[model samples]
Target chain A: MTITVAIDCMGGDHGPAVTVPAALAFVRDTPDASVVLVGQEDVLRKYVGAADLPRVTLRHASQIIGMDESPSLALRNKKDSSMRVAIDLVRHGEADACVSAGNTGALMAISRFVLKMLPGIDRPAICASLPTQSGHTHVLDLGANVDCSPEHLLQFGIMGASLVGAIEHNDRPTVGILNIGEEEIKGNDVVKRAADLLRDSGLNFIGNVEGDGLYKGEAEVVVCDGFVGNVALKTSEGLAQMLAFFLRQEFGRNMLTRLIAVLALPVLKRFKNRLDHRRYNGACLLGLKGIVVKSHGSADAFSYGFAIARAADAVRTGVLARIAERVAQGQTQPEPA
Target chain B: MTITVAIDCMGGDHGPAVTVPAALAFVRDTPDASVVLVGQEDVLRKYVGAADLPRVTLRHASQIIGMDESPSLALRNKKDSSMRVAIDLVRHGEADACVSAGNTGALMAISRFVLKMLPGIDRPAICASLPTQSGHTHVLDLGANVDCSPEHLLQFGIMGASLVGAIEHNDRPTVGILNIGEEEIKGNDVVKRAADLLRDSGLNFIGNVEGDGLYKGEAEVVVCDGFVGNVALKTSEGLAQMLAFFLRQEFGRNMLTRLIAVLALPVLKRFKNRLDHRRYNGACLLGLKGIVVKSHGSADAFSYGFAIARAADAVRTGVLARIAERVAQGQTQPEPA
Candidate 1:
């Protein structure tokens, strides 16, 4: 029942500077959890403070994956890299879960290659938790398999539903296929096929959800292929930033405008955070054999710490075991021919 | 030159309620411009006042295309419909340009079929005026062709550049292709091919632009496939709405926040309008033989008027004719194999 969290200490923009301290904070904050910081020992010590003195085990690794390095090459060449070693620890039962903010492609590939997928899972889906107007919604297949089959989308729905149930505490969370329109006959072949499969499945399929649905909590779980999902997610981020930038420009137009902006500081800050990408930094690589969390590479300490808690919650809820059992039991409802 | 604008009075959510008054106001304000209101006479007169109506003509039509009607079917069945008749006016030299807030798909198809594409133009692109931090950026192929080839994208870039030059007064605006990354070697096959094509073209091609660049004013013209453009545009709209919704929620959370919101009202209003899609509602169907403008279906009177102005601007600049000349001259720059 002991919770051991493996951390990729040399992964993000700040590398060990942010990752090592955050790992120590997580171990200190969570009484029942033990942390294994994966990186070169000499570098890890440089960032860790005296007060944070090696309370956690330091695992040595010779290589560090660059942020822009090719995903496959980084994983293949740097076999003992922090990212791969951390996932490997989870695969060998040395860690309860693995966390990294490295190159998303590398982390996803390494996790899938090392721990493998759960039974009935075609591929590992990346599910990001979005802070919606209503509450929180799970958006999946962010960039795992750019080209996905209807079956893969259906699996995404099931895994997303399961993850939301365990993490967000939404029982039987509604599942939706992202589409250009809500009609059953709307989207492309891929979307139509996914909708058909979802309809047949006994999961609480809520039909199609558009891009707006992701932020308004139109459904608890929104599923799509990696290509569409990646575009949708990045586009949303670009838009939020754009609006914020526009607000700043309008406010700086004149002296009176600057005064007005000062008065609305509190309200604007709240709005900024509500629409902030930083708040939705952590993502879960679901349908895998073990829990593997991925945070935004540019995430600060607060969000990085939150990712640790997210990972711990998933492990405690037995999310992976439940998915494996359901997948192994072959109880998925079949679509009519 | 007579700046006659033919409006499909049957289009839009409110239709004549928004379009008629807007047209009346435009005639009153502009003084020199003329308008031809194409729709059922009864519906048209109900919205437009007979007295003091300066240079306004109402053309009767028997059919109207509903939002849910199939694009091809509407064009075939509703031959003398308001939308069709309006475009016909431009085709037959009775009007300088045409405007419709109707079904976008139908408009693109009908315009291509009726007016025909300019010579040398492989594909016609839809160009929408978008408000950016710097001012306004022209984004094209917003939703005209969902599935596109590298060649089609190259056409979009060329057409978008020409449209921006005519409408925005940029002689040779900076052009950039939308992609996942900015590097020349980055993105899928389609993007790399388009980049090679653009580079050889000797247009002020600025290479690739990421999602974040759309609102940052990285380039005056941002060209993308219809599928990606549609998602990007819709995602931006959804995110802006979501941010505003969340801001209102936060403002109403407490009394102090509400007071702060009131004090910030002036700057907030400016900020809101800066991101208002309505201001940039109209999109020109570029590469066609005649000028055709499409406005948002949900636009109000003010938005409809702005759309009319947009249509007039395109006609005044002879943008369509210039595009046709470029195509006819076979002036396309060859790309490296």
Candidate 2:
């Protein structure tokens, strides 16, 4: 199966400098995959180089959305934006999937507006893989729906499970509700109701998992409302950044510590590599009719390639089909309000 | 003023083995402070030694509350538990504050039931200081109230500011609402309403703060519903543990790395010291008529002593009086339902 991904080359902090190279590298690495680099032809052409790679193609897009632009404004005004054009490619079935390192809100809004929601899905959710002790766990609704209902949470569980089933090739991934405690009596009314719905659902429902369970790999897929998930995700980022800063400050404190840092550089580098955030760069915008993955807006070429690879994997593994099928089976029926 | 803190000696994972030593060490370090150890008198006497320290005393309690017991069950049945007796001492004016390394739910429930809420406050909150880039930021409502109103959040902001004022001596500490973003339009309705209330609150309101801003030290105090706060705190712990595990695994991968690890041990130890979780062990149960601090159940003597110091500091600085005065001033009037 030849998986083609539409790349928003003009998006992200580095624009074409990061996205174009990442696209070329992705195509070079995967013989069964191709990428359509969508951006201002003039700018992207300069980075595309003299060697004409058959697997890599360029599509012209006149407008570019700023990283900090309002999502609504970008969705309404920037029709020819690389982000929109990339999603348009997926909508028209020109590409199997779309990937962008653009503004998350804008990408989400534009994707929803263009490709529309998948059948039986109310709102699309942002799903991303987080590094864990055993391997990694997929967490959904990182920042999509701030106020989610129990039905929405139930939907997130189904979509998340389908995502793991497709990507990890696991038919029944352990799904858990993100709560304050693992007990049934824990959490607010919505979570309690969602737990009931999940328990009845045919998926491998593991009940409630605490915050620490996310990194402990207690479940293959952890589902939460966007507000909670976003806070958890960003808080982790903040902590990791603070720890890194402290590590650098301590190692550079004095001459004696500096000497030890020099000797320990190799081991430190290896350790850093094992926990590299780049390895988990792509965040899948799940529950959409077509596959859409959002890369970090500040991602570099090497990091952005992971996003491309994720989009390709979703396409090849038929994640969208699995979600539709799961929902169609009527296993995720919500309780009447 | 000499402050008196009642210690729940039978609480925590180690019971008297940890709490007894911690109480003794606390009185030794804090000359102006005294501790009344509440637990099985015979069991604690064995650990208290024959010194008969002038500042240390023992109060016998027949029962012990299990760490895993339900909060409501412990509150009703374990009224004679060491946890209850310690709080009772504070209620009876024998002690100015109380410290416990016990079940957090039980501590909060029992504290609220015994000490009661301060005038004009509906519910209590759990406030704890987290290490940040510049210094530290105090966050409140960490698993106390899973669901909170805008009014409750405003109360939390007020209480957190008061705690910071008492502990850090900052009367006008920058206060912020924890949200997915720093923008006015970010977060759920409660957060948005809370932001508006905070703006008119006559306090040092700094508007919305993102998760990364917590570690960046953008605000001295950040307030949120207990659900969000607890998830953020526990998620950070999980990530830190995972990173530590990864670091150890990388260093022990091969003999060459092991030699480098030995050479770099001192620097690594210093780095670890700067990021020690034990340094921020105590969490203040704010909005109560009396001061109560909860220590980590797994804390050692040195770590648990911090909780004792926290309670003593709260008493010495008159944190309870400050919060009551602030609330009595009618600065936190909630909107009618």
Candidate 3:
């Protein structure tokens, strides 16, 4: 099946300078994939090569959304924005999925308004893959639903499990709730009630997984309220940046240490490549009627390609269909008391 | 005045093996500080040296609290446990403060029951200093009150600011509410309301701080509900561990890299020392009428010594009095609408 992904070429820090080239490279590399570059026609035209015309299509979008623009304001004002146009393609079935390196709040808000939500799903969650010791773990509600109910968390668990099952080809993925402790008695009222519902949800519930366990790859899918998940995700980023700074400072302290840094450069580079955040750039807006993936706002061409690839993978693997089916099945099951 | 800190010598993973020696070393090094070791007499006697006797006192407690025991059960059943005895020492004026490396929940419950809350403060918060780019930032409610009201968060800000003021000698520390975004509209209802309350508060209230801002040292004190704080802390720990593991794995990949690892050992060691968790081992249990500090359960002697020193610092700086004064002042001021 040929998967077509819509790209918001005018979004993110670099605009078409990063997105257009990323889209061209994506279609060139993936034989079974095509891309629609959505932005102002005159601006994006300069970035696309004439040789790549067969698989690349240019769709005009007159307006642009600022990285710091309010989500609600952008939704109401920028009707023809690259971000909105990209999602509109997915809604109109012109594209199988959409990828944008834009403001996360704006992307989420626009996608939800355009694509709507899947049946039986009360809210859309921002699900993203994070690097772990074993491999990677998919955590949901990164910043989409700040306040989530027990039933919403249950839906997240179901949607997350379905996403993992579809993408990893694993029939049964281990699902766990992120909590302060592994014990059932731990956490607040919402977390405790969510745990009870998940226990009887018929998924491969692995009980509570602590914050550290997320990196340990203790579960395939970790569910949390957006408030907690967003903090966890951003905290990890801040810590990684600080550690890198410390390493540089230590290595550059004096003449002897500087020599040692040169000798160890290859190993350090390899270590960095193994845990590169660029490899995990795409974040899925789960539970939407159509697929929309968000890339980091500061992502460059190389990292943006990963986000486009992720959207294509979702389309090829039928992740949206899988999630819809799971939610439908969950609605039939009696609610957990 | 000489500060006296009661030590729970029979607590933590290593029990007397780690805690007793740490207490002895602490008193030996600190000229104006003494420790009253609370534990089984037989277990702690072997660890204390003759030279440490002048500044150390052994106060025998017959029972012990297991590390994984339920908090309520431990609080009610283990009245004679070393953990309880240490808090009891502070409550009865036998010691100016107390330090424990026991189960956190048990310590909080026992401390609250014994010392009671300071006037106008609803609950205790776990405040700990984390390594940041500039120095360190003190984050509070790490795991004490998982679900916090806006008023509870406002109280936490007051208490955290007071603690920083006492310890760091900074009377007007900048405080920020932890949120997913820096915008006023970001986060759930509690955090938004808390930000409003903080703005109207008498303290130096900076606006919303993102997760990454915590390590950036954007604010001196970052206040959040216990659930978010706990997850952020543990998530940082997990990421740090993973990075360390990846570094080791890469360095030991082959004979050439192994040789390079030897050359890079000094630089690597210095980097490790700069970010050592031992230097930040103690978490202050704030809002209690008396000062109580908690050490990491898996801390070694060197790390546990920091917790003892922290308790001494708290007592000498009169942190409890500072918090009481701040809360009382807050009560007199009109509540934020």
Candidate 4:
């Protein structure tokens, strides 16, 4: 099986400085893997080595989605943008999958517009691989569909379950709906309806998982709408940073505390690495016609490399095909919605 | 001024085992602060001390709200529940304010029912202090009202802004709506509607704030629907646990990494303290006719003490009176259906 990943060269906070080298590193690491660098040839060449440059194909894209541009406008007008072109590579079968650290909204929009939704799939949900206390869990619809129906949430459960299966190697993943509490009749009307649909969907549905359960990794798949999902993802990121900042302040409080910190050095280092976003850099937008993985915007070379590797992993694991099969067979329908 | 805190002794994960000691500790620490422990006399006496318990008062109540009970059902049926009695103390001016580390849904439901909403207030919003990259930011509506209107969010902004004034001492706090992006035009229909309303309402609106910005303390007042706020709060809690787990695993990795960990000890402890929920354990249910505060169920005596302190802060700062004035002055508009 061949895996070719389309890289958006002109994406992210640092652009080609991070994306180009990351792509090269990924290809070098995986000798058999192929990658297409989509951006202006001149800009991309600066980051790639001349000796081994030809190994990575450079696809010219005239348009580039600005960080500030409206997603709908960019998707509609910037048809040949780097992000769109890279997504097109997967749609056209030129690449097995696509990866980008671009505008998340634009990436999601293009993935849906170009690659289209999987058969019988009402919407494509974005699943973020988050590190948790127990291990790791997959959080879905991290800003894909703003409004979701009970059936849509059920579909997310199926897709999230399948994705978690591929990543966590759990044949029947435990699925949970993100809610304030762990009750059958909690949350708003939508969440309540979704819980009912999920419980009867024939999946290994765990009752509702509260916020604390997320880190416990009690459920492999945690499902919610884009708005909530996005909020969850951001809140996690914010808290992580907050903790890091606070830790520094506490350590610096006095000489005695500083010495204690030094004695506990090894433990602290290990802890920081576990919470590092780089370890789980790439997130796959599931239920699309093809694989489209998003890396964090502020990700460095190592993180971007992980995103490329994640795209390759998705292709290797045949996530899209499994989703297609699931959708095609109408196996994703909720028992009752 | 003497501070009297009404504590729901029957509420929490371990009930009186945790709440009783926590209340005693608060009174011991703050000489002027007194506590009214509300619960059945027998259960209250099991945890309450005899000698130094002079500052503490017991208010007997036979009913209790089970954690699994629906918010509406518990609020309606458990009229004499300890949570209700604790809140009633604040309503009747028997206590300056109230604190409960129990079922969140039940607390919100009962608090709103007994305490009532301020004049011109459509709903009472739950505002929690979240650890951010910057010191602190208050994210509101963390499960007060699930189905929120634009006006509800606007009210949240007003209440949250006043909270910043009271706590952070910010003259006119910057308010931001929780969205996937920082742009004014981004987000779903609800966010867009809320943004439009906030912009016109004549507050210190700062457009939309993404999840990542929460820790950055970009906005002193962060507003969202109860559902989104609750998810965000839970996600932060989950992420913190996940990071802590990862750090422990990393610390146990090997000898070489262990050496680096030693040098980074001070920084790590500071980080943990900065993100610790204990530092900001209590959140006010804004727009209530009287002050009501909710504490984390898993709160230790220290955190419960902080909850009592927080309630005192709200009362001393006259937050409810300020909110009543803001609502009456027509600073925020009505929600459009």
lDDT tens string, model 1, B1-337?
Answer: 6699999999988889999988888888886699999999987877876553668998998789988788889888989899999999989999989999998878988898899887777677888877666776788888777667887887887888778777667767899988766656556677788888887775688998877777778888988877667767776777777778887888888998888778777777877777777788788888888999999999999999999999988888878766765556453544324
For B1-337, candidate 3 gives per-residue lDDT tens digits of 9999999998899988999888888888999988899998877778875444787899989999998899999998999999999999999999999999999999999999999999899999999999999999999989999989999999999999999999999988999999998778788999999888888887788989888999999999999999999999999889999999999999999999999999898889989998899989999999999989999999999999999899899888889889998888873344335
State each model's CA lDDT, in order.
Answer: 0.82, 0.91, 0.91, 0.82
lDDT of 2 at A172: 87
**DockQ, every prediction:** 0.55, 0.81, 0.86, 0.55
Candidate 2 lDDT tens digits, A124-166? 9999999899999999889999999999998999999999999
Per-residue lDDT tens digits for candidate 4, residues A43-159, read 887777555554589899988898777778999999888999999888899999988888888888778888888877878788888776666788888888889998899899889
Cα TM-score per model: 0.94, 0.96, 0.97, 0.91
Model 4, position A6: C-alpha lDDT score: 91
List the lowest-lDDT window of 10 residues for candidate 2 chain B.
B328-337
Residue A325 in model 4: lDDT: 64
Model 1 per-residue lDDT tens digits across residues A1-337 = 6689999989988888888778888888888898999999888878774344534888988899998888889867989899999999999999999899898878988888899878789899899987777787888888777668899999998888878777656657899988876656557777798898888787789998877777778889999877667777776776677677777888888998888778778877777766667667778999889999998888887778878888988898888876776566563644224
- Candidate 1 positional error at B281, Å: 0.6
lDDT of 1: 0.82
Check candidate 3 and list the clashing pairs.
Answer: none
User: In terms of DockQ, which candidate is stronger, 2 or 3?
Assistant: 3
